[model samples]
Target: MSDPRHSVLLNTGSRMPLLGLGTGQLRGLENLMPAVDAALAAGYHQFDTAAVYRNEVELGQALRELLPKHGLERADIFITSKLAPRDQGPMAPAACQRSLDQLGLEYIDLFLVHEPGTEGLRVEDPQNSVNRAQSWTALEEFLSRGKFRAIGVSNYIVRHLEELFASCKVPPAVLQVEFHPRLAQTELRALCAQRSVCFEAYSPLGTGALLSDPVVLEVAKGCGRTAAQVLLRWAVQQGIPVIPKSSNPSRVRENAQLFDFELSQEDMDRLTGLDCGQRFDPEDPSLVA
Candidate 1:
């Protein structure tokens, strides 16, 4: 990761690195510091975390110490966090403030509603819709107070986005969802483009489960790249921002080396043909909590 070769302009008038590190299931200084330190060493300025990640304090401290070591500052790193499912509705603002407190930052670069569904309420419940609308209003308050630069949603489909748009005064600036060559999310990407929302891909490599896919391997070999690079590049080339989490420094560096290579029409098409609406981690309402 040395000077990430590309950046995407966010709807909030900010430039976000197309390739960043995702901090999930990474908790405590023991687990987070090394990755954060290595990511910074490898030149990763963008990071994605969440309230439910239980590692915000660690992420915050790592950045606080590591940024200066890299000759960088808070302004140099773009951090994104999300609202937990348990914090939906009017409780959203409190959750936002809590995340701010956990990160020990004056302002957050980006904030997102973790899901259209929640922990306390059944995902299929009609109340989820009401909670979503009220949550958007609460998020707006957080934005107005300068707690965050931009606000968006995660795990949201077109219908969910439509609902958010219908009730929200400030539409979402970014939509974070699982995406990879095999899970292209074409219609959702189109929806975001149509609405001027920057679409972001999480698990761009399908949570490390798609790295060994036949198509990915073939494309990587033909391009003289790693499967991870091929997969991340696929999303970037399509104008979707991607965050691929890895604890290995080599893999982290490899993930950001996409700008140096270009995927030819043939390779691109082959990879595109791999899409079958498959997802390694499907959004299960039963597991929302």
Candidate 2:
């Protein structure tokens, strides 16, 4: 069993591991299997993937092969997949089903809308709002049907979340975004806190750009941890779940060694002070209507 301190209770009464293995850019059984093996051995109980990542099939295969070897079952782990932007609105149901098919899962622990805007639609288009509402409605139906244990959205900003709140019957259980020391996302985090939405983080290492940062390096040195550990620690220490992706087996194991050490208040403050609202992901949800 994973440490209780490493997991948080979602609004849907599900326990989500704060330190998950991100499957973005990790494709093929050859690449994903070892990472999955390392993750499982390192006590990771959560795996996050998306349709856009185009590796759900391989991830499913890897898990099926690796979980038994690790003495684990489907119920012991949490899996998350997403509806692609191309499949928003009327196509959401099919997309959700396809993700389940690709992942080879009877039910995903979480399913998130991968982006705020639909494909081929302008950010300011009114249809985006309608499509988002319809998509959420479809997800709500799936939740009722037990296709998804919890539903959420990714890369959504304040306006996007507010619009969803006004119309959604079941509020989101999680809101995943690119969060790190450089991109603290204070306002969005506060809104999610107020709404009881679990604010989760992806790219917590700033998409590999923050590893060499002087402040991060200094903090890592002070804590005798790797830069990746320091950055991931900054988020999970705040009770924010994080999925920091890496295909290297050693790095995967190394990344999971976050629960042993504690950062001082001064170190935490110094890291938080690095927030300049810098976002590493190219897709800016703020541009979406």
Candidate 3:
């Protein structure tokens, strides 16, 4: 990894940067390369993308060129990609391989199901119904073959996890979710802790709300840090690995400069109190129908 100081060693014994660069919103071939290049230049070694993002080929090009030019190799970075909703079921493995081809990587550090059995677009159910159990079975085969170093699911609820536990043979190593001060996800956090699933929080800045919060701004002023820095620190202190997306060069560096400060118990409690179940990307159960 380029930035050793900002790394968070995961339970799988892999050292991933606590602050990952998210490319979910990054679009267009032109926008993708420069953003990725900016992130890499800022010393970010973890990149999060998905097949559905449709920028994998461009991202792959950026990585393949940028790393070698900077004297960095593939292993020097941790890359995560996901299997899309349509690519589930018996075709999941081949679909994963396709993603690998697009990423131009031999092994992915983490592979996740983009969403749960929503819309009946699972591998096991052809009737367009949510059949997570069947999809998970396909995930198991990928895990068993070491195609992915670690495997998990994204956007899963408590019920989804419960269902997974009831059916899966191997427990998930990580669970990626939309987490921030606004959407603290207390219940899911506690459940993951109980189950030994490392929770990785995406959009830890509340999709920019926390960055503009009055309370966060106040704290940032007092602490001599940006609101984004304060928010990132809050999540890191909670031991939740966070990936904050940014294409701006300065902002990318600012996001990674969060390890120096530690939030106090009082500060943590104060931040925790900001939670009101304000999920930026709240899942609708009816979508599963």
Candidate 4:
């Protein structure tokens, strides 16, 4: 069983593991299986993926083959996937179904609107808001039908979330965005806390840039943990869930060892002090209307 201390209770009354394997650049069953095996052995019970990643089929296959080996069931693991921006609005229902079909699962644990805007449209297009509402409505319908146990959004700014709050029938259970020591996302985090939304972190390492930072290295050395672990811990220490992507088995195992140690308050403060609103992801949601 996953340690309860290492997981958080979501609004849906389900516990999501704090440390999850991110299957973003990891494609192919051969490549993904080992990483899944490593993660399971390391006590990770959640996996994050998206249709845009194009690895859902592989991830599903890996889990099916590896879960039994780890003596786990489908319900023991949390699977999070997203609806691609291109599949926004009217295409969302079919898109949600497609993810379920690809994953060979009856229902998804958590499903997110991948971005704030629609594909092939200008960022400031008014239709982006219209399509987002339509997509969210479709997701709500799926949630009602039990196709998705929980629903949320990704890369959404404060405005997008406020608008969603005003119009959505079901509030988002989680808000995932690019967050790390360099990009703290203070406003979004505060909003999520105020609304009881689980604020999740993607690109927690600043997409690998923070790994080489002198401050991160000093803290890692002080704590006898790795730079990756320090970065992930900084988030989970504050009740945030982090999905750090890595295909290497050793790194996957390394990333999962976060709960074994804790960072000092000073270390945490230094890390948070590194925040300068630097975003590694080039796709800025603020640009979307």
Give all candidates' CA lDDT scores. 0.85, 0.94, 0.78, 0.94
Colliding pairs, model 4: none
Per-prediction TM-score = 0.95, 0.99, 0.90, 0.99
RMSD of each: 2.3, 0.8, 2.8, 0.8
- Per-residue lDDT for 99-120 in model 1, tens only? 9999999999899999888677
TM-score of 2: 0.99
Better of 1 and 3 by lDDT: 1
Better of 1 and 4 by lDDT: 4
lDDT, candidate 4, 133-229, per-residue tens: 9999999999999999999999999999999999999999999999999899989989999999999999999989999999999999998889999
lDDT of 4 at 174: 94
Give stretches of model 3 more than 4 Å off.
1-11, 119-130, 285-289
Off by over 4 Å in 1: 1-5, 285-289
Candidate 4 overall lDDT versus native: 0.94
Mind giving the per-residue lDDT tens digits that candidate 3 earns over 112-223? Answer: 8878754445434434333456667777777678778888888878877887788789878788999887788888989998988888999899888787788888788878
lDDT (10s digit) by residue, model 2, range 69-154 = 99999998999999999999999999999999999999999999989999999989989989999999999999999999999999
